[model samples]
Each structure stands twice: as C-alpha cells, then as structure tokens.
Target: MADLKKTELEERAFETAKTLLAKYQNPHNLKLEENSNLEDCYTILITLLYAEILEETEQLAILSIIDGMKLLDGNR
Candidate 1:
C-alpha cells in the first residue's frame, strides 16, 4: 500500500516536472531532442526552479519532485 502511494506521488511529481518544463521551454525558446535524458531534463528543471522566487511549499514540492526523479533513475 505504501509503495503504491509512493508510486502515485512520484507519478504526480513527474507530471508536474514535465508541465513546468514545457512552460519554461516555450518562453525561453529552448529545444530538446526526443531522446533527451531524464537526468538532464531534471537538472535543467531544478536550475530553472532555483532561479525563480518560490514559496516554501513550492520549493519543497520541487525538492520532492527531484527526489522522485532520482528514485526513478535507481539512485535511491
């Protein structure tokens, strides 16, 4: 049950990351190939997130999203 919940949370985080990345990319005119690595996208996302002024909740969410990404990478 716990694992299922964790997986669901991770999926949500991943979706959030994807949505944010798309929004960021569009405004900046950044382009990524179809085969771009997840870790590379994660790095760019984190860097961009840190560049902005975010609330504590928003920061925590991004940290959790990054952790979720790392776990997906089998780093956790």
Candidate 2:
C-alpha cells in the first residue's frame, strides 16, 4: 500500500529477500570480500531485492533481474 511508511516496507522486504538468498551463499565466500565474483555480487543484490519484496512472486523477481542484468551487460 502506498500509505505504508517507506522504512517499514523496505525493512520487511529486505529481511524477506535476505532469508531466501541466504540459502545459496557459501559462508566461505565471505573470506575474500574484495575478490568476490560477479555471481556472488549478483546473489547479494538479489537477496537485497528479495528482502525488499519478500512476498513477491519469485518468477517476477527473476525475470526482472534477468532483464536488468541484460541492460548492464549492454553497457560493456
């Protein structure tokens, strides 16, 4: 709802997204934060998105991310 406070929604969504993304990230990868691969960074971004839209359909999120990534790829 548009009436909801921005912080409340963001916090809830971020928490939701993080929980789902946490399922895939390997703890050992945290050892080399600066050298983390793009895949790992993507995972983190997706997790952040998830936490923001915890109740969102995964298909929609995946599709959105795929489209967004394509735009980034084009910049290269």
Best by TM-score: 1
lDDT for each residue of candidate 2 in 26-70, tens digit (9 for 90 to 100): 433422243344455456655445544444465465556556557
TM-scores for all predictions: 0.45, 0.35
lDDT of 1 by residue, 1-76 (tens): 3433334544555555565666554455444444445554565567668666656766787787777766767954
Q: Where does model 1 exceed 4 Å of error?
A: 1-11, 18-27, 30-44
lDDT of 2: 0.48
Lowest-sum lDDT 10-residue window in model 2: 26-35
lDDT of 1 at 76: 42
* Alpha-carbon RMSD, candidate 1: 6.4
